[model samples]
Target: MNQRVLAERARRAIPGGVNSGQRNVPGLSDLVIAHAEGARFRDADGKEYLDFHAAFGPPLLGHNDPDVNAAVAEAGNGADLCGVGVTEGEVELAETLAELVPSVERVLLTSTGSEATFHALRVARAATGRRLVVKFQGCYHGWHDSVSLNVISSAEKVGGRDPISTGILPEVLEATLVLPFNSSQAVRQAFADHGADIAAVIVEPVPHNVGCLLPEQEFLRTLREECTKAGSVLVFDEVITGFRHHLGGWQAISGVTPDLTTMGKAIANGYPVGALGGRADLMDLFSSRPGGPAFFAGTYNGHPAVVAAALATLRKLRAEPVHAHVFALGERIRSGLTEVFDSLGIPALVTGYGSVFVGYFMTGPARTYDDLLRNDANMFIGYRRRLLDHGIFELPLNLKRSHVSYAHTDADVDRLLEAAAVAARQAGGEVQDLAAASTMGGAVR
Candidate 1:
């Protein structure tokens, strides 16, 4: 059946015809996938496209990797969920994380990134005896009330504490201080006003959710230093940047460590898993013994099959040149697309690092959410639609960044660039001369 029929059927059972609101793009056609494997997936319509979404940054080795599948099968054969027990795979996976991630001395496994972040914040509150938490304007931790403010907004209210959803209590919104990302002055001001009551400061070391905004080195250092001085927990939400940016996460790349780190996306390849780990003293709050205060428990915290897949993924990542390979592909796509858009006289900017990349239909480099306002979202979405028509599966609908997997070959990159050229031409218009738009305060690079 067609996607329309499937979507109509889904709407009868599920709200908005989707499990998540953002599953399908706002004004785009429904994308129903039939099956996916290795660098590509076939949609319900039987059309196969080269997959750059990579299931939203989890499939670093690509979809359905043989080793990961084999490991999953082996672990699945062992048990599903022995409710009152622990699995050897969980132990091995935790050990691998402790060894790989610099900040992870102890780990508490959860089912999703949202759960990990929620518990991490709870641990922070318990450790510091504080109620308020600080998160940057566009750095998304998860859907939890503590972090559901100012993550996604239009250009006008980009820096305010605006909750995207309605059900979040005003008290919860008040507890979160949303500051402009990459602005140390704002960070200082927030701490200056509420440092005493601040329980934790959580951030995505690299803010990929807003189309890949890199944190200024000094900005991150300032966070580290200020949190140190205030005795507040510094939590790095590395769900998107964990293994994709590096095996040790962006902390390894930046040399700035957090007291607690929450990661999931690339942890178990593409399996359902999330981990909250950090300094032993702080993580000790999760101990449910006679003395411990914080209670953290989940039935499928570390499912055997998922942990087994994670273990296998970690082994392969350690043994292979995965980062080098994927980074090259990412850079190629970035530069190639930038060249394609530029040559076609389309005002565009490419931003990202390592294995993740995104293109904005704006003249200037996007540093903050406000800066991203200059982007032509309509044009960007139209361009991506043209690419989809050309049989290239990108992050559908929105201008979310693209994930380059180790399974993507040089030929894949070439084909993507080729498709991008066509898309750029189809979406092209009068060349935007930043030199001319400068009078209007539009800067270009």
Candidate 2:
């Protein structure tokens, strides 16, 4: 397809004409990618890129790993095309996760992360019979209205959080209580104020949607303890972190098994697979028709291709110490990029866990909505465009934290830092080299 023709055609009839909102970025919409392989791909215009986005981190082994591709190819050939039946793939994948995450007693798969988070809340309310749901500011739990508040709140904003979208009815926002992430004090305050009425407190243990905002050391423990004391279910939205940071996701690393855990993204090696599983009592959400928590049915929620891919992915992950490699590579990438910014005399810091870290030319140890929001968005956007031009692709979603995937080699890390140095010179304000580079490019020198 002609890149310009495809994009123009999409805009004509496709209601944004793209699968996800992030694809509609000003520069990205102008370039449509045709095929991807390994760690690189070409746009419709055939400009090759070092794919840093990597499908937002699910392409951990890199795009089109031979094994993953083979699995897909074989499934497409003839492997449980029925889409529903007593297939060993689903059971094997579930077993792998159960063995990996102690909290998971039973598992149900879905097509995307949103569904997993959605049903987890349903399970919580059904199990606890409470209506109120507590979520932190800046954490995104899909598009569902109950958890939409505080997604885009900047640090300087008057109130800590403002509902990110408009179509969501105000009544839905009423059920959501927004608390500052990484603040055990605020969580406690909410519990004291609305604990009795709240059925569950859902959160991304590490909020990566708006740059990666890690919680304080005692925050997770406090969340668990308070939720327990108040008789409310604690849900960990592990869609992005699941199986990426470790075998069991945040629950394993933190040693705090939530009442409910949602898994997606990497769960099926980029295939459309998600799951909500935890304590058996809390899993009654999947009960038989008319008896379950509510409606949880969809035709392709648990497709066989995705299930097989997940089984293959988990088998490999379980056999290999992926996190160990990721940790080592992450340190190199973070250190390399940190040095780049520092050498340029720019104000930036890199922070995150495992293979995920971000270069923020703003602050260090970002831990809350306030911390991430207060960062330099202007510089961030400028750097993003520069990186894309220099062949690195990152989602424009709040410029939170970025990732260092398993596929990233030492060369990849080196190039990333090199790219950072190049982009730093393009910063619109006070960047010494940026002035010279801009002038040379016929921009405002």
Candidate 3:
């Protein structure tokens, strides 16, 4: 079937014709992916495109990796789901997490990143006996009530209560204190004013949600110091940065450990798995014992197949040169895109950490959401949309980072750069024409 037929059928079944709100972009929503292999996927119309989105950075090793798939098949042959007791895979996965991640002395498994963050916040509130939670403006922890506000807010609502979705209670919105990213003073002040009432401060170490607002080392250190001084739990939501950035997580690079860490995305190489780990005392609160303060239960928390996928993915990451390969490709894409835009005389900034890149239509580096306020949203979106027409697939949305999977090659990087130059020229010409037309109209007046 064609994309149009599939899309029409989907809209009648799924709300908004997409399962996730982020998948509902104009150019992307209509696309029906027929199949995906390493580095590329084909649409229902039988056209192939080089995939840089990597399904929002989950396919770290790439789509349909044989090793990961083999592990899943092997594990599924022996065991599936036994909800009553723990399996060997579950114990091994948790042990592996504790061994790999720095902040994890103890851990709990969940089915999704949202569940992990929800459990982390609950543990923090219970451990501290506090009511308020702190999060940065552009950092998205999860879709949960506690950290759902102030992501991608407008200028007027930058520092205010701008809930991403309706149906969140007023009390829930108020409970979350949204502050600016990369501001040491703002973090310190929030802790000073509400130190006694604060339960936790959660941040996305790099703020990839707003297309890579690189966190200052001092800013992260300030978070650690203030949270320590205020006796509040510090949580790093590394769902996007974990495993993909480094085998040890972003904390290894920054050396600033959090009281709790929530991780997912590439953890299982596109399989459904998430984990929350932290200081042993704090994690013990999730125990179902009589005196345990927090509650945590899920039937599919540690499904055998998911655990197998994660174990296999982590093992491959440890044994192979996955990080080395992807990181080099990431740098290649960033530099290539920078050269392309400069040649076109288009003001742009491409910023990201290992294996991720985001092209921002702005004048300078973005340290915070406030800095990103100057980003040209229309040009950003238009450039990505035009890239799709050139057979390169990135989510045509503002503030979304593109991923480089281990499956991609140096040749693929060069092809993307060549296509990007053409796309940039097209998008740039349209913007220039619009500016000229506006100036001429003003002169006539």
Candidate number with greatest lDDT: 3
Model 3 Cα lDDT, one tens digit per residue, 28-134: 66777899999999989899999999998999999999999999999978877878788899899999999999999988899999999999999999999999999
Candidate order (lDDT): 3, 1, 2
Return whichever of 1 and 2 wins on TM-score: 1
Minimal lDDT window, size 10, model 1: 427-436
Please provide the root mean square deviation of candidate 1 (C-alpha atoms, Å). Answer: 4.2
Worst 10 residues of 3 by lDDT: 436-445
- TM-score result, candidate 2: 0.92
Q: lDDT of candidate 1? A: 0.86
Task: Show pairs that collide, candidate 3.
Answer: none
- Candidate 2: Cα lDDT at 303: 72
Comparing 1 and 2 by lDDT, which wins?
Answer: 1
Query: What value does the lDDT take at residue 333 in candidate 2?
Result: 77
Report the C-alpha lDDT of model 1 over 372-437, residue by residue, as the tens digit: 778787677777778887778786555588899889999999999999988777765323343357
Q: How many residue pairs of model 3 clash at the backbone?
A: 0
Leading candidate by TM-score: 3
